[model samples]
Target chain A: MSMLQVSGASKRFGGVIANEKISLEVPEGKIIGLIGPNGSGKTTLFNSIVGYHPLDDGSIRFEGQEISHLRVPEIARLGMLRTFQQTRIYGKMTCVQNMQISKPNRNEGLMSMFDRFPKEDLARIDHLLEFVGLYSKRNLLAGDLSFGQQKLPEFAMALMNEPKLLLLDEPTAGINPTLINGLIDRLKRANEEMGITLLVIEHNMRVIMNLAEHIYCLAHGEMLAEGKPEEIQNDQRVIDAYLGAH
Target chain B: MRNTILLVLGTIIAFAVPFMFPAYQNQFAMLWLMILFALTWDLMGGQMGYNSFGNVVFFGVGMYITAVIQRDLYFDIEEYAHVAGRIDALTPDQYLTGIFLGMGVSGIVTVLVAIILGAGILGLRGHYFAICTLGLTIAAGEIASGIDYIGAGSGIVTPVFPTELMAKGMFFYFVFMVLAVGTFLTNKWMLAGRFGLAVNAIRDDEDKAEAMGIRTKRYKTMAWATSAFFLSMAGGAAGNLFGFIDPINVAFAGATFGVWMVLMAILGGKGTIWGPVIGAAIFHITQELFWTYLFGWQRVALGAMIVGIVVFFPQGIMGFLRQHWPHLFGHKVDEQTTVEQGATKESEA
Candidate 1:
């Protein structure tokens, strides 16, 4: 059964059709890759699924409940989150504080946030910071981290939420080639060890081919192809539409 | 341990000031009230990263509400305000009852107003939010002056304390001092928890905070409402002390108290626990000195001082200290080396 389902989803932006009747599925505890050329509506579909804006038409379901009409934070509270291509982190905050603040406060009362933060949670924050190999720099301001290092904190921040599904937009973008393997390793561990379902929009062909079991290709606001990673790597039309552009 | 000592010493000095400078109760009280203004302003400006110019809306609303409630309790406010504050009305009992009840009502009303206004206005980002709030403050005074019942162009006089009450200045001075302490502690408590982190996140990046599962709108509204809640009580205290509520002069003086709040907070290190306090003290003390010695030319010199501070010390006093003595603020000098390298890499990206 799918953990997330999007069917007939459509979004338009002032005479521009960003996503038109696009549909996809994210199966539980598996890694899925979304590949497309620039302006091919991959990000737009992710935005619609995560409730960044109101979709003009169609349905999105998480655990089989319609969520297309909900706002971003509400959708996040239901255990779905997305990361940006241009990383969004509190640059002025310490890395661990970022983790603590990202812990889902959906049910935390107004006053409960003021109480002493639990000791176990603090331990968990440290564990996640170390998971991202950022334990040494945890005390430094996030603004003081290199671009690639910043993404690690952002990754750890999303992990702190313990979201069942995470949509990563270009997670491997802007990192050195040497660090790409480490990120891929962490992504797989997050899926296999931690039971997170991922639907990633990746521009890196090699990273996606290595990381994904199933892949969906989007081109010009439509799902161009859906298949196993091996099948997608050999598709003729996908080669002409997206891979050629890359 | 150092913070604890400073806290104790600060409290002792605050309590002792009225008695030590017995003749200057009014000035001492004003100092405490100004601290309230600066601290509340910092909640949005420093913590939340919404530089608002209209927080005085709460102060004015609280003043009017308290005055209207007090007068309506014993006499019709319309007639009294028109009489140009010459009434010998309201026995001490009625006056006290009205003042307390008004304050209680003002607290609730101000919170409601804040939530509604914030829900509407806080949605605007950056400069629009600042200018919109500024409009709210200036418009409030103009609108209040036009209303006949609350005093129209004429101003309402607050219930004068019965002459039997002793040490008017000292009593109000201590009252404001207690209020200032309460505001400071509440802010400190908030900063020690997720509230502080969440707000700083908003300041740093609102879009990212929302993506992290924080209900950004709710946090923004709550921050503003929190500022409104305490500010209303401080307004209540200040209103009674002022004994008059001219729409422009006392209630909504955007040029004075309204502007002072933001200026004072910025003059200290914004976005830190002790920044506003340090800033308020320096601003109040310096302005007072300027007012005394500069005389007629004070505004001219004060304007230059403001310009100088903004241009040279935009980070404020605490920011300056943090840069030079980071260890005192729990930072290692080695981190600067890492930070500079990261900044260069970031710019290249």
Candidate 2:
């Protein structure tokens, strides 16, 4: 069964229709790729699905419950999480601190947070830092990290609440090719090893083709095609859309 | 090691200075009060990044309430000083109530005022918030002047204490200790809590903090309230120390006090836990020395000092010291590391 279902979801901003009745299903435990050209509403769809924006018309069901009107943090608590197009790690914080902010119990009210979880959490932080390959630079401010290295902490942060479904928005936008490959491998390992579902929005066709089990193409805020990676590559509509044909 | 020893020595000197230099006791007490006031201002202004300019409102309120209770109400205590007469005249509860009433009334009034002002102005970002608060101080002064019962503009002179000088000295010391300790603990508590994290997050990026599940508005409101509580308490203590109250004393001087506190915090280190205390000490000392020695051009000299500090020590004294003496001042102080560590642990799990 689908873990997340978006039906007839539409969002418009001052005459600009960012998403036009975009409907999609994200199955549990599957890696799905969302592909679109610039301004094709991939990020908008992601935002709406994750409750960052209210739907102009229609509904979103996460874990079989309507969550269209829920606040972003409420949705996050319900085990749905999204990463940003731009890395949003705390610049002055250490690599491990970025992840700790995402801990479910950290927000368990102020009194309890103080009473419990200072020393134990600190130790857990060290372990997580090493896990993310940032143990050596754990003491360094996150802003000082290279662009590619920053994404690792960002990814780690998204997983803070141990979400079942994770959304990545252009995860490899400005990073080097080597880091891109490394990120894909890490993401794949995370999915296989931890049973986490992944939905990625990417313009990089090669990375999506390698990482996603299924691909959906969007143009002009509407779905153009959906199929397996090879099938998507060979689709006439996708080629025409890429080639600027109507 | 050297820093620890220096701090210890500083504490010893602070304790002994009043006793060794009898002529400077009043000066020392005044400076200590200023330091406490500045520290309170910095917690809300610098550490929380909310730049308040109406702290004097609470200081004035505290002073007035304390003055009214100690002089007007408690003067009856001396009138019935004969043990049997006093016992027959006033109930124990009545005396206790009067004491608490002074503190409670002052605290509540200040908090209410702060709330009204904070609700209206805390939504403003950056310098606008500061400016609005500053304007409120002037408005408050005018309003206080109109209140006849509270002695309007001419001011209310407090009755002299019947107690010995030693007792007054001890009272000042106790008050100073409470304010200093309160300021220090509150600063530490904030920096070590989720509220602190939220404030830092808000300071770094408001939109991001909201997106990250932080209720930015709620946190900001709480910060304002916390600031109001301490500020009012400090003001009440000051009122008792001075034994007087009036519109100008509470409101006009409050505005200046607010600015001075902000300056001290910025001069020491805006957000650091101990920065405000350090800034307050340095600022009060400099101001006292300059004002006492310079006579006529003291204001000009003080203004120049403020400008010089701002320009030369943008990050304040703590930041300057850290840069110049990393070995002495350095510690694991970055906020980002804790955030990253939290994030990484979740991914691994």
Top model number, DockQ: 1
lDDT of candidate 2 vs native?
Answer: 0.73
- State the lDDT of candidate 1 residue by residue for A10-128, as single tens digits: 89999998988888888999999999889999998988899888899999999999998898888999999999999889987878788889888668676665656788887788777
Q: How far does residue A10 in candidate 1 sit from its true spot (Å)?
A: 2.2
lDDT of 2 by residue, A140-194 (tens): 6677788778887777766655778999999998988987888898889778887
Q: Model 1: how far is A73 from its true place, Å? A: 0.6
In candidate 2, stretches whose alpha carbon ends up further than 4 angstroms from where it belongs are A105-107, A113-117, A240-246, B1-14, B64-101, B108-139, B142-160, B165-170, B193-195, B215-219, B246-249, B252-255, B323-349
What DockQ was computed for model 1?
0.38
Give the Cα RMSD of candidate 2: 5.8
Residue-pair clashes per candidate:
0, 25
Cα displacement (angstroms), candidate 1, residue B320, comes to: 2.6
Global local distance difference test of model 1: 0.85
